[model samples]
Target: MELLFVFLGGAIFGTIARYTLPHRDEHGSVLVPAIGAVVASVVWVALTWLGWAWDGGWIWWVSLGASVIAVVVADLAIGRHRVQTDAALLTKLTGSTATATAH
Candidate 1:
C-alpha cells in the first residue's frame, strides 16, 4: 500500500512538472517527463534521509508538491541558460561567417 502511494505521488509530480513546463516540441515533452521522474526520486530520497516519516497520508502529497516545484524551478533555470548559450553560439557563428566572406 505504501509503495503504491509513493508511485502515485511520483506520477502526479511527473505530470505536474510536464504541465508546468509547456513545450511545443515533442522531444521536449518526452524529456520533461523523464526529468520529472528523476526529480521525484531525488525528493523522495531527500525526505527519507531527512527523517521524514510516511505514516501520514499527507506526506505523499507534500513530497509530490515539493518534487513538482523543484522540477519546474530546475527546468526554468536550465532553459534560460540554454537560451543564452544558443544566442552566443549564433552570434559567434554569424561573426565568423561574415569575417570569412569578407576575405
Candidate 2:
C-alpha cells in the first residue's frame, strides 16, 4: 500500500539521522528507525482521516517531514539523556567524596 512507501521513506531518513548523529553507538539501531516508521504511519493515517487523499502530495510530504524531524530530535534527546545518566551513575558510584573539583 502507499502507506508502506511513506513508512519506508521515513525509515530511510530515520536511519540516516541515527547513523549520522554522534554517539549513535550508545543506543540501539532499531529504536530510531522504528520511531520514524511509526511516526510516519501515524501521520499518514491522520492526514488521510482529515480528508487528504491517499495519493496526496501534501500528506506524503508532511508525514515524511515530521517523521524525520521527530527521529532526529528523539535521537539527540536519547543520546543526551544517556550521557547524563552515565555521568550521574558514575558520580553515585564514586560517592559524594568525589566532587567536581576532585578530578
Candidate 3:
C-alpha cells in the first residue's frame, strides 16, 4: 500500500538523518528513524482525512517533509538536552564546572 511505502521512506530518511546529524551518540539507533516513520504516518493519515487524495503528489511531499522535519528537530533537541543534562550531572557529582572545563 501507499502508506507502507511512505512509512518506509520516512524510516529511510530518518536513518539518514540519524547518521548525518551530530550528537547521534546520545540516543539509540532506532530512535530517529522511528520518529520519522511515526511523523510521516501521522501526517499522511491526517492529510487523507482532510481531503487530500491518497495518490496525489503533494500529499507525499507534505507527509515526507513533515517526517524529516520532525525527525531532525527531535534529534537536535534530544541531543542538546542530553548533553546539558549530562554536563549538569557531571558538575553535580564532581563539584566542578563541566562547561568551564570544556571551554
lDDT of 2 by residue, 1-103 (tens): 9989988988998899988987698799899999999999999999999999887688888999999999999999999999989888887887754574586
TM-score of predicted model 3? 0.92
Residue 41 of model 3: what lDDT? Answer: 93
Any idea what lDDT model 1 has?
0.63
Instruction: For residues 1-103, write the lDDT of model 3, one tens digit per residue.
Output: 9999999999999999999999999999999999999999999999999999998899999999999999999999999999999988888877787555766
Residue-pair clashes per prediction, in order, are: 0, 0, 0
lDDT by residue for model 1 (1-103), tens: 5545555666666666666564323236545555666666666667777887868655666767766776677667667777777767876987875775776
**Cα RMSD to native, each candidate?**
4.1, 2.4, 3.0
In candidate 2, stretches whose alpha carbon ends up further than 4 angstroms from where it belongs are: 96-103
* Cα-based lDDT for every prediction: 0.63, 0.89, 0.94
Which stretch of 10 consecutive residues in model 3 shows the poorest summed lDDT?
A: 94-103
Q: Of the candidates numbered 1 and 2, which has the greater lDDT value?
A: 2
Query: Cα RMSD (Å) between model 3 and the true structure?
Result: 3.0
Q: Could you say which candidate leads in TM-score?
A: 3
- Candidate 3 ranges with C-alpha deviation above 4 Å: 98-103
- Angstrom error of the Cα, residue 60, model 1: value is 0.7
